[model samples]
Target: MLIGVPKEIKTHEYRVGMTPASVREAVHHGHEVLVETGAGAGIGAHDDAYRAAGARIARDAAEVFANAEMIVKVKEPQANERAMLREGQILFTYLHLAPDPDQTRDLLKAGVVAIAYETVTAPDGSLPLLAPMSQVAGRMSVQAAAHCLEKEQGGMGILPGGVPGVKPARFCIIGGGVVGENAAAMAIGLGADVVIIEKSVPRMQQLHRIFGHAVNTVYSTRLTIEEEVLAADVVICGVLIPGAAAPKLISRDMVRRMKPGSVIVDVAIDQGGCAETSMPTTHAEPTYVVDDVVHYCVANMPGAVARTSTYALNNATLPHILAIADKGWRQALAEDEHLLHGLNVAYGHITHEAVARSLNMPWTDPHTFVRD
Candidate 1:
């Protein structure tokens, strides 16, 4: 099988799909890998590195796309890249299709086997492919929230870890999943008052056990979320419902109740957002003010730290890529139930029920696409 790795073209996106190590793995498996020139440069990976790993370097994305059977990417395919897609091509990437009708339509029309990273579950019901980036984004959320809390950034001029005479900032994390846990851990480490809102009792107990007296855990309800949001100096929205759009736990009206200059870093912005005011921002211009509240909603937050993100993401996605390359998409999906969950669209059909319901499109059972 021939695999293509294209440079990410999304605005301020600097992460590529694969690394030199990943290329070497494919090459070792007797698969041909074509990498776009400078595809890994943003992630500190050079052409010579890929060449050393036995990967052919293509001058442009067109050549890689034109020659490869499977295209591996970090983000969703941009408009131009989508136009270049061939029917029945395999697109393995983070396709957050629930919030974007246009992207959903384009993927369906292209007739590509669209496998979403966020939907690829593990045996334990954890999102394996999405975890690496989520870990990066979750940690970065605290960093971004701290920066946005400075006065120059139009924040309250409070320090996250205050001086001897002053109190540290308060952090409210929505959700108790990976992102929230990481953010809360960081915030607690910085001596900030951290509260995590969780819906699951077992998860909340786990969080309590993990943090003990270092942080507070709240059972997420409308009243509790509102109270926490109003009191928090830094609000990190990390709630996610897997492939579906993240629930809006913080409303516009709730924003009004927040302290002036409070910062919101919505880690779930990729799956829409948990905060109502969040729209996609870029790394170049990562923040916008809403009712004097700072919002850091860069859709690709992990991309800001491209090198770490690239290696981490590749580590998680490489095995799945190999599976699809070794076995055809149909065979791979038929063999692995978890991999089948990753298939959002295939051959002009909506194979993922969540995406179909989100876009109000007709759904075809994914099993229909698997032929014995």
Candidate 2:
């Protein structure tokens, strides 16, 4: 099998799909790996490193995409890249198709096998490939929120952790999954009054145990979310529904209710965002003010720290990439139920239920295609 890794072209997305170590693994398994030149440079990995690991360096993305059977990428194919996709090419990446009708249509038109990392679920119902990046985005949410809270950034001029005799900022985190947990940890560490709104009772209980007095766990409700969000100096939107679009928990009207100069970091923006005002922003211009509330919705938050994100993502995705490369998608999906769930679109058919429902497309059961 020939695998390709292209440099991320999204604005401020510096993370590459495959690291040098990941390339070495593929090479060891007798699979040819092609990495586009400077693909790993943003992640502090040079072409020489990939070459040292037995990967062939292509001068351009076209060469890498044109030659490989499977293209492993950090982000979904942008408009330009999607145009180059050919029939039967396997695109394994974070394809958040639920929110983007254009991208979904393009994938079907191209007839490529689109395996989404976020949809891949383990037996324990955990997204292995999405977890590492989610953790990174969750942590970055706080940093972004903090930065936006500075007076110069048009925030309330409140410090996250207030000094003696000063009140600490209030942070409200929506959801209690990986993103929420990490956000809570960061907010609490900064001495802010952290409140987590979670729908799952058991998860809330676990959060109560883990955080004790450091964080407050609330049973999420319309009133609760509205009240807490309005009171928060910084609100982190981290709600996720696997392959589906994130629920719009915060309404446009609600944005007007929040205090002026409040900061909102919608970590769920990749899935269309939980905040009604959330529009995909780039790191070049990461924030926009709506109703005097600053919204930081950089879709690829983890990409800002490419080196850390690359190594962290490789740690989780390499094993699955190797499995797919060695066994082939059919064999790999047939053998691993977890990997099978990741298959979103294959041969112009939507295999993931959530993606199909979200996009109003016909759904095909994954089991029918990957039956052992």
Candidate 3:
């Protein structure tokens, strides 16, 4: 199998699909790797490093895309990249298709076999490939909120961890999953008052057992969310519905009512955000003001820490990549039920139910394409 690694083209996205170590592993398995020149520059791995790892460096993305059987990328293909996709070519990356109709339409028209990392599942029903980036994003959300709280950043000039005599800033996280848990950990470490609003009873109990008195766990309700948002100095929306678009739990009216200078870090922005005011921002301009409240909705928060994020992502995705490379994608997905869940589009059809339903499109089961 010949695999291609293209430099991520998304604005502010610096992570690469494969690392030098990943290329070496693939080469050892008798697979050839063609990486675009400078693809690993963001992670401090240069062309020489890839060459040393037995990957041939292509002069441009066009050559790599034209020759490789499978294209491994960190983000979804941009317009130009999508145009270069040929029928039956395998694309393994984070599509986030539920909210992006343009990308989904392009992908369907391209007839490429798209496997989304964000939708890939593990035996325990956890998203393995998406977990590392989620962890990074969760941890970064607090850091971003703290920055947004500075008076220079148009915030209330409040310190996350106040002085000995002053009260600490309050952080309200809107989910108790991996993102919410990691956010709570970081907020607590900063000595902030933390509260997590969750719908799952077992998960809330789990959070309580983990944090004890360090954090507050509340059952999610319309009233509870409103109260939390109004009282919070910073609200971190970490809600997720897997392959579907994130539910809008925080309304525009809610944003208007929040205290002036409050900040919202919508970590679920990739799935279209949990707040009505949330729109995809970039690392270049990460926040905007809405009714005197700050909203940080960077779609690729992990990209801000490219080195750590790249290594973490490669650690989780390498095994799956190897599986797809060693056994053809059809065989690989047929053998692993969890991996099959990653299939979003194939032969011009939407294969993921959640993504299709979210977009009001028809879905075809992934099993229809798997051969015995």
**Could you say which candidate leads in lDDT?**
3
lDDT tens digits, residue span 178-244, model 1: 9988898888878898999999999988998999989888988899999999999999998888778
Positional deviation of residue 187's Cα in model 3 after best superposition, in angstroms = 0.4
Model 2 root-mean-square deviation: 0.8
| Candidate 1 runs further than 4 Å off | none
> Model 3: residues >4 Å from true position, as ranges?
none
| Model 3, CA-based lDDT | 0.96
lDDT of 2 by residue, 77-140 (tens): 9999999999889899999999999999999999998898899998899898999998999999
Per-residue lDDT for 79-168 in model 3, tens only? 999999989999999999999999999999989999999999998889999999999999999999999999999899999999899999
Report the backbone clash tally of model 2.
Answer: 0
Which residue window of length 10 is worst by lDDT in model 1?
239-248
Runs in model 2 with CA error above 4 Å? none
Error (Å) of candidate 2 at residue 6 is: 1.1
Clashing pairs in 3: none
